[model samples]
Target chain A: MSKQVHRTLSESQVTAISEELNEPDWLRELRLDALQSLDELEFPDVIQTPGRTWTDLSKLDFEALVDPEGALEQKERVAPEGVEVLSFAEALEAHESLVREHFGSVVDPQENYLTALQTALFTTGTVIYVPEGVEAQAATIRTTMAGQSLFNYTLIIAEQSSSVTILERQETADEGDFDERYYSGIVELVAGENSYVQYGSLQDLTENTYNYGLKRADTDTYATANWIDCNVGSRLTKTSVETVLSGEASESQIVGAFYGHDDQHFDVDARVWHENEHTTADLVTRGVIDDEARSVYEGVQDVGRDAWNTSSYQRENTLMLSDESEADASPKLIINNHDTEASHSATVGQVDAEDLFYMKSRGVDEHLAKNMLVSGFFVPVLEEIEVEELREDLNGRIQDRLAQRTA
Target chain B: MAQLEIKNLHAKVNEDGGEEILNGVDLVVNSGEIHALMGPNGSGKSTTAKVIAGHPAYEVTDGQVLIHLDDEEFGDEEVPEELQTWELLDLEPNERAALGVFLGFQYPAEIEGVTMVNFLRTALNAKLEEREELFEGDESEDDEDDEAGYETSPMEGAADEGEIGVAEFQQLLKEKMEQLDMDEAFAQRYLNAGFSGGEKKQNEVLQAAILEPSVAVLDEIDSGLDIDRLQDVATGINALRDEQGAGILQITHYQRILDYVEPDHVHIMLDGEVVMSGDADLSVKLEEKGYDWVREEVYGTA
Candidate 1:
């Protein structure tokens, strides 16, 4: 048998990954350019900022990051027959011109270091395209890491008048050393006029693994995008949900839930920009932190100049169970125009002592009481989920996390 | 037999003005009796109930709250010296609830995430735990470990069974709502959210019937109810004493509710203390004779 392969995020690795998928030249160039820029771009000072934390990203070993090539090679798990779940290189070779035209055009690289690096060197990811006026049930991508940094991507384009839901999940089943394993990914969604796109991400990396990712979407006139993010893992993680309503009468609703335990550090930053008239957006993030874990939530809703009659609201609430657990939330609204209604509310607190006491007084143990409060914390978001199976899965994952923390 | 007693309860609110709300109010409520406290607004009727329920806003300056359960009296006196504050404040609203004290809030707090079902289960479990400690004593709790190799004792099993199941609990809510002339569908709604005045009062009565507190303090339970809703609430409260044998403390400003509920004992409260008390007729007498008689009798001037 051949030796087990270990891969790093390097120039040749990107080339090899692209070649493995037989990608075209332009796509390969994009990967190389992204890799080269990764070395030059400085990771932003996320910590010094009001809500950001200075997590030690330098300690992460990119050299030992395993590729898990076979992880995304399966055809049976193909996300819809028409959609492609291949590496960036494969997309370049098979649909070069298509990838080039739509890849970095939606999200600019100069926006941030993470966005630029993600735009260039995203080796293993998927591309989904729903042709004009043809609505598909959903496009799903499941990536499994066998002890490695399994960075994935999902690029969805809902053509004029079409609608699609994209569900991406990251999980691992490796018995190998997990202390050094990590995953970072980015997904971009572009919905054309009169189109509807709903994107959901479920993260369940190993307890020792660290995950950082970003999700950004842009909606055209008369279009809508709904984002539902459920994060239930990672020792240290940061995610950003960004949206730009560029088309008139466009709207977006972003909702998410993050449950963490132990020494987990989970950060959720949501940004919504209204650039057109009559556009509206709302974001609601609910989270639960237990044990020694910590959660940070920062949300910004901005109504751009001349984007009149735009209305936006954002709310973030977190429940901290244990004394050591900490939660921080900052919600800011910026309106450049006067004819806009922009509002935000944030609350960071512990479980209701009276509620806890009420449950305990009924003979429920302390552990069960905590679980009930946790369940209550997530019930609002879970009820908002349209899909029943996915909702059930999220509920199960939340319960599992609670069990691990109490255990 | 369970009995809750209050003696010379003196309490105050640390407002900017240093107002003393309850000034040496004395009363005795046996195991099964309905006591109606009537007076105008700000007459210290609600303060008395809040002090007994351990509300932090009110400080009990001097008083002894004795709770008798199964022939044994447990209060601040029986508790250890190290546990004085624990026996009082640390016990929490739920702990007091487990010990058979329930407050039907004059204004119920609206909580977003907690559902009525889950909230009830938690409270039921706490009450069961307190009941277990009361029955098993030390030897019985220790025997649980020896027998099952688990922490749960025999009393726990019976408590578990005695506690209503989910379906049965839903049915109970339905029955109680129907008895109160409320819509059965209201059970699924959030507790106390968007409730009108009469609805809130009726909801309190419904909770009292369901929880069956040893001492039920209905603080201003008649302030906002229409005539029909008032009658329904009164009927539901009367069932609490007639069926479940729970002691009731009906705190109200107007005697309108007493006309329907008919208190066994009626007490008149002045600035911060009870000035006069008598049988059911005192409620009508207070309405007819008014505060003039109370002022003349208690303060020696009308």
Candidate 2:
């Protein structure tokens, strides 16, 4: 076999990033190992029919997207009492032991090619930890990407019986001089026994940016984890949100909403594993694609053999606003336990003509009627959002996208 | 001059040059009159109503729907005209609605995500926009008119010139719901989604009450309604007529609803055309003899 030359990044760059952060030797070694794995791993494989690959991730040019020396600027809000929100550097300085113990535990460094790239090159991130039995209102992290390649990470850990909500927003600064950029965001959440954690993420990068995001959570006994993810901007977005109900009676809910327009593309995947008895998981995702945009969604609910009496449900619906727009969805259920209850449904369709005409007949103009129907299509998923500000922000973004298209 | 006039109307399904459904139908509904259009299934009664409302599905092959507005009621110093005539056939459905033409659908489309309150408020605001010339001057004038109980313009007190405030719209919707004996919770529900037949019919009536259109075409609004809901909807329609002097073209398959709301004129249609026209007793005769009698009377054979 011939050896392919695939090292757009070098060991020295990885060492430089780790050294710049003044990380411990173990963390630096992990980054170096992840950097080495990038050459061997390939972009995530997408579904392929007889003649066509649905999402061609290999088409992305990683060489043009690598900038190991890019700067990272993040603005974080102060978390409430009983909650500790710190940057990666600050966390390492103040709570090194705790950060070393929990960081990269939920999301392994060798998860995938994109995750390995993120692990090796991420320049900005935050660590949020909630004390035992404490209830914290919120911790907010906002990032603005401006350079050619930017990688960000977020880690959230809720101790036993503790509860916390985290809101992370990713945006692109209005710097028109930059070339087509790339973004990779990695998020890991760990909820301890009887703990609660809610994570809401919104990514609104510019059209010239390609976004790759992987978010995963681990739920302990009687713990609950909820995720609300909204993606509206990007030239192309490939994202996955997942959870593992590792302990008995643990629960998780994943809610996702996205809007794509103007030749943009999105490939979203969500998965949940009921590994213990009586675990429950619900996954709901709704999106709208307009213009020549395209989207693909895959949801997987896996019930393990020991996951008896488990309840898992998944539903994904995509609304197409234009005839040229396209969407494909696959919702799958893998049940290994006879006592488990699992259901999954996926539908891809255009705006209901009857619904549009009904509203128009009542004097809502054509554009407004279409907008209303599109907005309404997202209600089922939006209602799953437990945070008020996040829900409103997502709603406003959807409305803005609709207005931009019609305008 | 305030009337809805349909003259030798011809229409067809809009798709693929579909076959004609309404063939040379003529009707005139004047203000303050309730006209009952009685017909069997597929007699084009609903088609006529949809065509008048400018539903996009039915193309008007050749027709003229003229809406004549009373200049004293609609005109202001802007144009200073005594009467206004609009060719509704050229207008879009929403434009027709803005011109005070409301169509209560036989099977009201269930808008899954839009609440009844939002839909009604938007429709009411559009209706108000159509009458912007009526309240063109200032807010003080509106206040004075409100103090005088808005006897001059009942709808003016319901909406502002641009957009109705949310609280004001809620209040207006509540009042209309009360008038129709509808539950206040209905406002929060999706428009017509999962609603019972009676509830859908009552919701249509509630929309009419809120919009206060000059002319309302109720297409089989009483079809699925029970006796009590039929009476409530009838009373609501009567209230619209009495309060706004609105002309109603009530289409029905049976004479059940006419018992609650008397019609001044009853027209029996068959084969896409009106075969017989008479007073309210005509409905009773039709109920007793069935539409076959009208077919026989008009064609000289059963």
Candidate 3:
């Protein structure tokens, strides 16, 4: 692989990535359209942040990071029966007719960097489609990211009255691991009328990797989506997760937790927009920061004027372990409808001194006391994750991180 | 040979040497003996309790605190390093608690997330593990039967199956709470959170009763309690002493609790030390003459 620089999102770049993956004309057209949208749209003005520099594209080299085109690559990637997993290139060729229906529906190319990579140069992606009224026996699709500095798109659509659970785990083992690579990705989830969808993402990128991700879900006509995100890796990560209730009696639960140590910088921005009547949403996000690590979480629960009886609540809490560590929590709620109920709460501080004192008064040493307090801080978020294995794994990783900081 | 001895104890609130609060307090509380320290407000009774519990705000300028468990002596340089001495004069609060010392705070903080069951189970298991290690091999058949009893119950099956279960501990806690007349439902809620003053005091007593420390220090348990609730707390304390053999160090400004619980000895704290000692009749005398008379006659106060 050459350490060549890939500059600009042009037809050539799109063709290079598309041709390398052997993507069909439809996927190529989608990529080109997404890239055009990315070039035409402007960045959002939600917060005051520094502009994105070109150095952030170090991980998207076409020749070095991507698989060759039309290499039977999708056929080699296997998943459980009835739970299909195929790359965007394969799906664009084999199921090209249905590609237009699901691709890029949740995250528009106009919305920041979500679709820009796909628009410019998309090598591969995982497309998950659950047929109407089909329910998963267990967590169905387990998507694995194995390459270094990889950029992937995951599009999941649960048809009317269908239910499914998707768990995505990103890992790199060996020479292919790009320590300083950048991973920019997006996930689009849509639940049709009376459907239920649960998507869980575990991002444990290498210390040298920088990750930027955006995920959104649209619930229509009593549909429900439970999105659980656990971020325990990467040097710097900026993520946005949202759920839009677009139908009457639509509901969603968004649970997110991030544990960072060392010099890691992580930011999570989430928004839940209730665009229809009788919609409801629940959001709880927690972060534990140690050493010189910094974490910022910004969340908003917006209830529109047409959304009557809309109930929503957002809570963001951060526990800082070291004197040098920093955490910023801002949970905002914008309510345009007077009849709707919306509440937001944000807390940033060390563990309660009284709590520490109480635990200490019971024979638990200072270190164990802090551990117990930190564990309790994440209990609610962890409990929201229904999968036992994933929950325990998350807890173990958090405990290990805490131990390292204390050591 | 259970004894809690305080010798020439002195402490101040501020690190920069503020006013001397507990000045040369000398006292000894032995097993089966309930000693009540009676004094007026700011007489250093509460400070003595806090100092013994290893409150960080206070610095021990002089003196030592010795809590002897059976034949083992704590807080002494003479004890061997492997003997597990608390060094109460310099120990942290948890270390003191682990050393069989318990203090019922006058105002226990309402911890939000720590449930009563979780806190009590952790404290109990720590003590249980310590005792198990100490009393290995010489364990009694009754103790074995109790362990087997827990082994037989399907309730402990969850724990035996590898999950961190608290069913056995919850059962023990329920029985203890029943003794304290505390609602069993309260045990499922957050520890002392949203509890009323009387309920909070009862909670403290409940924990003391459950943990069954070698030495129990109750500060102002009688304050703000009605006669009925006072009698309930007194009954719970009496039960704990009779069953657990815990030495009671009751710090109260009123003689009302002594009327029901019946302390074996009463000490009057004037400045920081015990200024006067007498039998239970002293409580009656203090009730009749009041703290004013004691301050005037004992400390030469006008």
Best by lDDT: 2
The digit string of per-residue lDDT tens for model 3 on A37-151 reads 6534533333433553312333334344333232111123434455556677666666676667767677876565344653455455777777788886434333334554456
Mind giving the per-residue lDDT tens digits that candidate 2 earns over B34-64? 9999889998999999899877788888869
Q: Is the docking of candidate 2 incorrect, acceptable, medium or high quality?
A: acceptable
Per-prediction TM-score of chain B? Answer: 0.81, 0.87, 0.84
Here, model 2's chain A TM-score works out at 0.96
lDDT of 1 by residue, B1-302 (tens): 35666767788885655678988887767557889988878889888887777776777778766655543323322533332222333355556776667787777654444555445534454455555554445655643211111111111112232345656776777787788889875665555557778877887777777776767778888877888888898898889888777788889878788888888899988888888999999988888888888898888998
TM-score on B-chain, cand. 3: 0.84
**What CAPRI class is candidate 3?**
acceptable
Query: RMSD, each candidate, Å?
Result: 6.4, 5.2, 6.3
Find the number of clashing residue pairs for candidate 2. Answer: 0
TM-score of chain A of 3: 0.87
Clashing pairs in 3: A20-A68, A20-A69, A21-A69, A21-A70, A22-A69, A22-A70, A35-A119, A179-A208
Ordered list by DockQ, greatest first: 2, 3, 1
Best by TM-score: 2
Stronger candidate by TM-score (1 vs 3) = 1
- In candidate 3, what fraction of native interface contacts survive? 0.26
Please state the Cα-based DockQ of model 2 relative to the true two-chain complex: 0.33
